[model samples]
Target chain A: MILKTNNLCKQYQHKDGLVDALNHVSFEVNEGDFVTITGASGSGKTTLLLSLAGLIHATSGEIRIKDFDVVNASDRKLSDFRRKHIGFVMQSFALIPYLTAIENVMLPLAISKFKKEQKYQKALALLKLVDLENRKNHLPSELSAGQQQRVAIARALVNSPTLILADEPTGNLDPSLSTDILNLLKKINKEEKITILMVTHSPLAAEFGNRKINLHNGCIN
Target chain B: MNIRKLVWLEFKQHKSQLISGLLAITLGIAVIVGIRSISVVSEKAVAVNLDNLGANILVLPQASNVDNYYAADIDAPTMPEEYVDRIVSSNLEGVDNLSPKLTRRVKVGTENVVLTGILPKNEITSKPMWQQSGLLGNDLKASCAPSNAVNQSNGYEDEKLQRKVIDSLGADECLLGSTISRKLKLVDGSSVIILGETFKVSRVLNETGTVDDDRIFIHLHKAQELLKIPNQVSAIEIMGCCNAISDGLLSKLRNVLPDTRITTIGQIVATQIQTNKMMNKVSLIFLIIIIFVGGISIGNFMWANINERRKEIGMLRMIGFNKATIYQMILAKAFVLGIIGGIIGYILGTAAGVWLGPELAGLPVQPIPSLILISLCISIGVSLLGSILPAYLAGRIDPFKNMQEV
Candidate 1:
């Protein structure tokens, strides 16, 4: 297993009263599994993905990535764990605008233990895997939305993360482009044997995963 | 790997903001350094004047061959040397320096030079010029220094060289004034035939831009022996009397040495310190205002950088960047901007200082490395101080919230 969660919960103190974003979620993902989380806009699929990624604090419960408890770790330690173990792909392709495509991929490796040349070589191979070798030097603005998403995906895998938490990876793309991205993720999952946890609201997006779960009223079904 | 690239990307993307911040520091530092340099240089000029030049009062034997208006001046009947001790014992707090001298015109190699014999005791000739002359003894050392007294004396002495020079001069060595030195083409450690004997040229006084420049200075005992007057001084020069106190000292000297003719040189000293203090007050006020504005510029720019890059920061956090690295990156940018501004300010400030010192403050201060370093620290310090709040905000940014904001 690459990730495990037990009764994990997250709450927000809104003016409307305490609202549960993640309510007693329990789940596990085996190595190399592609798990797609589906729900309505505010049904807590994104919140669960965030909790699993250690991007936000969970109100209560256990989140273990390969048996390392994340909830109790210090903020610094959590960042380290996230940097070394998890990768995130966002909806709008949050690639730094000033960096080129390959440089975007190298961002995760900036503080890595790899030497400079090794980091470069690793990033190069990932760019090739994402089929962006020719476009490596292009800025995000110069690339199409599809190409930018590819760069974003390559960035996510730069650290060879144990779990890739993608929040709406294809939401900004057309159906064909979305299908292409899903197929690439599936290909990466099978070939690299990496676990994938993705959140989305689209039924078509849900079909790309081997296992699908839905969230309603902050509870999993 | 590629940490510099990340920093460069951020700076490159926000060049205009960085430049404006840099301008603020530059302007602040430029004015501060320019005015400061003026004050520093002017103070040095004052010190040099106090160190090397005339006393306020001259006490001469009354009506003694009266400062020869036409031909070579003859030595007057000596003022009682006991009068030196009398004025000293009177506990006059205003007296800064006092030296007795026997003055006469002498023929040195066919050139008539005003030879003033001054007691080169450490206390008598001592008004600490920048350089220590072996002939002037410790009187040429820095005055009224602080605990960094050692620092004040550093490079001012070469004891061995001075000792060798002083050792050769007891009654035989003589110091050449700039005019005499140039006229005679004399160099230090050269043999000069004076008073029918070979005297070693010990050191030369710098050009004084006054009548002293045309004079040759020899030991008091040497001049007395040349004049066949044993144990008598022609006059006493009293230091520390500005125009403010010249009248009172003249009366006191006339009473103490009843047969002496007292005169005041009226060395006003220009009150350079007061003038410099006023200039300094103005500079400080301007500096504070400029620095505050520069600091705010840096702070505002940094905060905006954080705000604009929320998603980028969040992305970085997701990829394993920690709070410390985030803070460091932001602060490092500010620091680099500060350093750049400091360097530019230092160059421009030094130029302004050199140009304006003599014109406005009438003080010539050479730019030294220490002053340059101080200016660098000030500009950079202002930039860094401005980054604290922005760095805090950068560090505290929540990755998930950052993603949501975008």
Candidate 2:
């Protein structure tokens, strides 16, 4: 198994009362598995992904990713683990607007001890994998929506992370572009044997995954 | 691909937003440097002037007009030269050294020059032990004497003319003033006739920017003989000890020479010192105000920058950059701004100081090299101090919260 969560719980303080964003959720994924989490808005789909990534603290949980304890680890250890083992793709294609496509792909390796030439080569290769080699020098603002999303995907894979956590990767694209991005993710998952845990509201995107998990009111059904 | 490159790209992209802050720091530093430079040069000029006025006390004949200390000997009525012997015998306090002058206007090659007779140090020392020991002894070496007090006491560019009061002058040799030399077209060793007597020019005195520059200095006995004034001098210059001057030296000298007009240059020096002190205080106050205003401007600029880059910061955090790195990136931008501002401010400030020093402080100003480092340090210090809080807040930004925002 590459990922596991035992009775994960996340709560929020609201003016009305305490709200449960995640309630006793538990799941596991084997290596190279493509798991898609589906839920309506406010169903804790994003919260669960954030909790697993250690971006937010969970009320109570046991999340183990390849023997690294996500919930109990210190901030430094969690950051290092994320840098070395995980790649995150956001819905809005969180690319730094000032950086070019190749530079955006190179962002995760900024803190690495890699030489400048080595880093550039690695980022160029990732951009080529995502079919953006010719457009590597184009800034994010100059790129189309699909091209921007492809650049974000290239950034996510630059570190050769073991797991890719994509939150609504195709949410901002057209139906045709969305299909292209989903097919690219599927290709990366099968060819590189990298585990993918993605959250989506679209049934079409959820179909691409081999394992599907649906959530309603913070609980898995 | 590195933190440094990242900082460069980010700063270049958003530099437009920082223009106001950069300008504020630059202007503040420029004002401070300008004021300080003028103050420094003005004080130096004042000190040089005080040094040029070597003697503090001037004892002129009662019938002479004493409008200016430098020209007090010009057109002066004669007084009995026995007054020098009288003062020496009285053994008054603060009597360091005396240079009894007998000035007369004489024609030298169609040019009217003031021929002033000055008693040389050796001449004074040649007197009887009872008179010379009391005048040129330990008191002449005291800190109050201008020649012994400052390295540039005479403000002379020529090394040989550094001492305004020379030890001796040959009876047939004379020292020409800079103006007299240039006007008469004479050089050292040139012979000039003054009142039908030929005298060799031993040396030309450097320009003092005073009446002394238009005079000729020869032995007192020679001047007295040429002018036919025996036992009479125009004025007696007394180097009163600074400590005794405060202890009623002027009143004591007045009591001894009841028929002579006694004056001291202390009043003029005091007024100039007061003006310099006021300039120093004004500059200090301006520095404080600029720091306060400039610091706020920088802090506001950094805070706004942090707020605008919330999503970008969040993205970096998601990519595994730690809080410390985030904090460092913000401060790095501020540091760069400070360096740029400091250099430009220093250049502008120096120019302004040199240009306006004469108008404001009535003295020529020169750039002080040490101020370059001082300005840079102050600029960097203010930049860092203003950005610390904003940088801390930037480090605390939550990736999840910021990324979730539209």
Candidate 3:
């Protein structure tokens, strides 16, 4: 397994009592697999996805990515883990408004010790792969919703992370744009042989992944 | 790719906030530099005044006033030359320069003038603001030519040959004040007979806007011979730096010379010191207020900036930037702004100081480099202090809440 969770649990404590956001979740995805996790609102989809990416730690149980215990990792190590092994695409596309498309694509490599020219070359090549090389110099505000999303995808792959976690990658896109984003992801998954775990509420969006897992009330169904 | 590049981009994008923040720091730095310049210029003015007046303290012989009043009113009472020797031998600390003045009212030609005798020595030239024109008398130069060459030049002489012959008085040469010079219609080359003796004029002195404008200066021994007063002086002019002349010193002199009364320049020095102290205090208060006010303004601006950029911060975290990186970027922005503000403020303030110092204090000032460096640090330090809280806030932004909001 490229990623695994053994009865992982995460709880948020409220004034009343403990509220379980993720309770005893267990799942595994093999290498090169594209898995879409589908759920309704408040179904622990984001919490599970965040925990799997080590963006948040599990309250109990174990989370292993490439056999490294992410749940017990230090904050620095967790950040390094994210930098070197995982890429994330958020619902809003989350492009830095001040940076050009190419600069945004170069963000993940910002903390890396890569040479400036080398990082720029990698960013330019990724923008090319996303088919937005002509618009690389444009800012996020100047780009359309679809073009911005394409830039975000280029950013996620900048560090050449083995796994990509996309949270509602098409939530703000129109139907045609959503189809384009999904096809782009499928191409990256198949051509680059990079694993992808996507979280979405749309059934049509889940259909693009190689396998689909439905979540209800914080558990796999 | 580094924090600096990111900070520059952020600053470029947020022009309004950045400008306001930098302006505050610049104002604070300007105040610091301006105040420092003012202090330096004021000190220079005080020093110049002290120089012009000859000494921090004056010692006058106590002639009889039925009520301990004006010594200048007395006619015959004179302090013996022994007092001068006694004071010098007493080994008083901090006495840098001393000149004994012996005055006699004598008829020279048709005018009755106060003829003050001064030793033509280094002590005479040490007095600041004393100006003269023309040459030392040819007779005096023949007697003391090479030994007094440097001093003749000290009297503001412009001509090389004239300077070599000026103010190097022997026993008979004299300097006349502007009043005496104009009254007698005398240029520097004129001569006047006094008490059956004659002396050539060495210079026609400039008007000092002081009592020195009314007197004529002659060599000490010559005045003694003319007045028939051997080994007696009217007063002593002693000048040293601050704290050198005080009441305690006067008391010691009185004990040594019980027959005579003594007066010191305590009032003038005290007043100058108090004035300097008060000015420095006011400047210090202004400096403190500027720093705090500027810091608060920058702090508020940074807080608002962090609040508006929460989503951007979350995006950075999601893209794998650690909390440290986020914090560094925020502080880098503040630091760069502080540096820019400091340099601009330094330039403007120094320019103002150089222009305004002489205009206000009537003294030229060149602010030291150390003062500029200190002001720069203060400006940058205030910026760093103001941005700490906001940078911390930026580092602690919750990606989960940010995602939900988006």
TM-score for each model:
0.70, 0.71, 0.74
Q: Where is the poorest 10-residue window by lDDT in model 2 chain B?
A: B142-151
Clashes of each: 2, 0, 3
Q: Pick the candidate with the highest DockQ.
A: 3
Q: Taking the tens digit of each residue's C-alpha lDDT, what string does model 2 give over B1-406?
A: 8888999998888867768878888988898889888877765555445434567789999988888887889879999888988888888866766778999888898999999988766777778953554666432343343333232443444322332357778888888889989999999999999888999998988787878889898888898899999888999987666546655888899999999999888674465557666877887786677677777788899999889898889888877888888888989988988898788889999999999988997766888889889789878878888889899999888877533621
lDDT of 1 at A30: 91
Q: Which candidate comes out best when scored by lDDT?
A: 2
Q: What is the C-alpha local distance difference test score of each model? A: 0.74, 0.84, 0.75
Model 2 misses residue A64 by how many Å?
1.8
Give residue B272's lDDT in candidate 3 (0 to 100).
60
* Candidate 1 lDDT, A1-221, residue by residue in tens: 87889999999999999999989999888998899999988899888888887788899999999988889888888889888888788888888899989888999888877888998889889989989999989999999999999999998898888988888888889999999999999999999988898888889988988998899988988
Error of 3 at B319 (Å): 1.7
Q: lDDT tens string, model 3, A130-196?
A: 9999998999999999999999999989888889999999999999999999999999999999999
Q: What ranking emerges by TM-score with the best candidate at the front?
A: 3, 2, 1
lDDT score, residue B364, model 2?
69
Q: How much is the lDDT of residue A132 in candidate 2? A: 90
lDDT of 2 at B349: 93
Model 2 chain A worst lDDT run, 10 consecutive residues = A74-83
Candidate 3 local lDDT, residue B205: 78
